[model samples]
Target: MKKLAITCALLSGMVVSQVWADAASDLKSRLDKVSSFHASFTQKVTDGSGNAVQDGQGDLWVKRPNLFNWHMTQPDESVLVSDGKTLWFYNPFVEQATATWLKDATSNTPFMLIARNQSSDWQQYNIKQNGDDFVLTPKSGQRQPQAVHDQRRSGRHYPSVQRRRAG
Candidate 1:
């Protein structure tokens, strides 16, 4: 019975691993086909209790190999730009702009994973597919794990519905 349990566990692990590998491969293949894209999005962030915390709408332009400009126009104003090397964040409401290396920004932003084409960058997350949608969840031991993982269809790894928990 013990051997049976051990074998079952190992087989289950292999099946899950295979699924993750296939999803990752599919994602990388999809990313490679796109060089750039532009999209408009409305965002709502909620707390752990599912209460609305903040609402926003924005336009985003993403270029492959690490370049993007995210402009938020609602509920205040801000812009985050990455020049393939440096990450710049600007807030017109506060008149503040901060700069950091692109490497530093990718650790926390899921959008960074989409902007990146390398499969190596994706290894940090587990990818699961649901029909046309693929959900990417950051694996345990991340710098700061997010509680909600968007169920966005692989339409560039960003989902139409977003929910975030306030820390």
Candidate 2:
């Protein structure tokens, strides 16, 4: 009984610390001056059946007010670009590109508000620092259920950004 009580107390303490470690608010404050940023990282895509269909590394660039360029160079090759107004999906094998409105299109899209510091309605996210990078997950209070459903169908995935090694 005593061992069980101690284990329960330890688990509770860990949970509280995890919640307190989220750094979402701090990141939001720094975003004002962040005109453009870039990074290179690996992405693992899992389907609804929990199967890994794709895994690769890529370079990502983002400019304020919703502009992003993602170029995948390994495993498979593809390019996704968003120029604030239109989003483009370019396939090298098909030699074709499809364009759509940034707001209307959805998928396991990396550029969703999951990348932003706010919710779909522009409310700030619940942030947590997971090791070297920060994870920004939405709060239920601000996230609309309908939007969440729509995003799920589109396969929206937002893992925290991983830091790059210094050269």
Candidate 3:
């Protein structure tokens, strides 16, 4: 009876591990297809109580290997660009541009995981499919949850290309 229990436990463990591996693989496969992505976004900032504090619209462009450009056209005129090495935030209204290391800018943002496209990083998130959305929760318990909803009609949707993060 002891041996039977042990064998069953081992088999169950393998099944669970395989399921996780498959989930990760599926997510990675989707992300790998995203070489460049462009989108127009309307963003609303809300407080903890769900009161709208600010609203804005912008155009976003991202290319693989760490290159992104964000242009805000509503509520203000500003631009955030990353050329893989440095991140530049420019505000025409203030007539100022601030530059920071890309690594530093990406540290706390989802862009880090998406632009890096590292499988190791994928392991740090628990990924599951909810209808048409893929939800990602940080395994480290230090970050907010993010969901990826791809509007693409063809091919698998990945993390970086057309991801909508909802916390």
Scored by lDDT, the top model is: 1
Q: Which one wins on TM-score? A: 1
lDDT by residue for model 3 (44-140), tens: 5555355566778888788887898989898998999999899999999989999999877765445555566765667677777654566666788
Residue pairs with colliding backbones in model 3 are none
lDDT by residue for model 1 over 24-48, one digit each (tens)?
7776666566687777888777775
Q: Estimate each model's TM-score.
A: 0.78, 0.55, 0.70
Model 2, 5-83: lDDT tens digits are: 9999999998876664434444444453455667676765555344555677988787666788889888878898988
Looking at model 1, the pairs that clash are none
Please report the TM-score between candidate 2 and the true structure.
Answer: 0.55
Q: What is the lDDT of residue 114 in candidate 1?
A: 64
Ranking by lDDT: 1, 3, 2
Deviation of model 1 at 75, angstroms = 1.8
Where model 3 places Cα greater than 4 Å from the true spot, the runs are 1-20, 44-55, 74-76, 154-167
Candidate number with the higher lDDT (1 or 2): 1
